[model samples]
Target: MRDKVVAFVPIKLNSQRLPHKNILPFGDHSLSWYIFKNLLNVAGIDEIYVFCSDEIIMNYIPEGVKFLQRDSYLDGDMVQGHEIYQSFVNLVDGDIYLLAHTTSPFLTSKSIENALLNMLSGKYDSALSVQQKQTFIWYDGKPLNYDSSNIPRTQDIMPIYMETSGFYMFKKEHLLTYGRRIGFNPYFQKLNDIEAIDIDTREDYEFALKILETNKQIPIC
Candidate 1:
């Protein structure tokens, strides 16, 4: 039997960096609408739910998507992300879960489909979207992805895979057992810079809007 995939977008109405960013206007619909619509179009998603505490979010979402009323306490500023994940996984039943966020407005269905397909293939236990950047990276005041002694060109440096807040594909059981979205055996789904844009701050949101404005023909979802 094929595994059942349940995709969800967790929305918190009160955003600290950019207040009400999730419901902010993005093209014809709100910010969350893009990922919601994209998930709806993905072929293998058994169900799509908007896990949020606010019912007002209904107005922003498109039809055919169900809603789940989450506890408002999960929206607390001190709440750790894993707590919310655990809460949702315990509430919803599915063999696999596609965790997406409204901040990832440019996350395309193609990237989501590819990641879902890879997870279904059984070659890997989990998958998450990432962007490859070949730049000088420093951690703890030391070069992380390169050797300062060698001083190689940027292109010559090994590419660092940066995790994007776009989406995560993982087994439900694994999350329940390990309390992790990224399983031990995982696949990194590469996405272009534009497609991986996540709107966290005002600058990020403005940048995303600029991208859409620059290309009028670009698909909002």
Candidate 2:
């Protein structure tokens, strides 16, 4: 039998950068609702779990979505994403797990499908959505490069990739066995910066709203 694919969306209420951001409305619906709806539209997803601790955010959860009330131990600002992923691993029985965030509303079903397909191709133990970046990187007030004066064209340089906090896919057994989000090998699914935007501050929230208004169109859920 094929393993079922489950999506776990972890949302915490307390945010130092943007307080109560999960429940904040983007256009007409709460932020969490937008993500939850998108997950539901994906073709191969068997279950969608919304993990949250805030009552205000919980109250707005739409129908047809599973709600997992987060425990106090896992509801702190310092809690890592791996902790939340492990918590869901304990509660559910699925072969594949997809960890996503509520702050990124631009994640489309096509992107989700691509990530899953790439993970299934056997080239990687886990796959994550990332934004490929190319810029002069600095560390400790010093440039870290093989040739200090060689600032090649942005396109020529090897692009730096970052996990966009949009989505992650991994096998449940791999997570339980390794105690990590990814195993020995991980693959990256490159995404555009606009599609990878996550709300971390008031400025970011404003930017998301502006993007939504400017587009005047939300991708099909």
Candidate 3:
């Protein structure tokens, strides 16, 4: 039997960086509408659910998508992100889980479907969306991904993989065993800067709006 792919979006009303970030209006719908709708269009996803604490979120979701009311305590200010994720995985039963976020509105369904197909192929234990960057990066006051002594052209340098909260495809057993979305062997799904956009602040939201306004390739609702 094929593994069941369950895609879910876990959201909370509290947002210190961008107030009500998930529900903020984007085009004709809320910010989260795009991801949810995008998932619905994917053929690989067996089920789609919005795991949230508030019932008001239902207003933002489209028809056919299900809602799973999560425990309010999971949204506590002191609670860690992993704790909340573990709780949801424990509650819902599925062979595989696709952890998606509302902030990543530009992640195309083609990329998502391709990642899901890879997971179904059984070659990879998990998969994550990442943006490849060849720009200079520093960590702990030291150059990373490139040697400073022999600085090379940006395009010639080895690219760095930065994780995006856009989506994570993992087997249920892998998550239950390691308590992490990325497994021992993870497939890095490459995404361009536009597709990897994660709206965390007001500025990011504005930038996304600008993209939608100018990027005719992106579907508008």
Q: Find the candidate with the highest TM-score and give its number.
A: 1
- Ranked by TM-score, top first: 1, 3, 2
Model 3, span 104-184: residue lDDT tens:
988988888888888788899899999888899999999988999999998898889999889998888877887878888
lDDT of each: 0.89, 0.80, 0.88
- For every candidate structure, what is the RMSD over all alpha carbons to the true structure, in angstroms? 1.4, 2.1, 1.8
- Off-target runs (Cα >4 Å) in candidate 1 are 217-221
Stretches of model 2 off by over 4 angstroms after superposition: 54-59
User: What is candidate 2's CA lDDT for residue 18?
Assistant: 86
Weakest 10 consecutive residues, lDDT, candidate 3? 212-221
Candidate 1: pairs in clash: none
lDDT of 3 at 23: 96
* True lDDT of residue 135, candidate 2: 73
Please report the candidate that would top lDDT against the real structure: 1
Candidate 3: list runs displaced more than 4 Å. Answer: none
Q: Which residue window of length 10 is worst by lDDT in model 1?
A: 212-221
Q: Across residues 43-158, which tens digit of lDDT does each residue of candidate 1 receive?
A: 99999999899899999999989999999999998998888888888898999999999898778898899989998999999999999999999989899998889999888998
Q: For model 2, give the 10-residue run with minimal summed lDDT.
A: 142-151
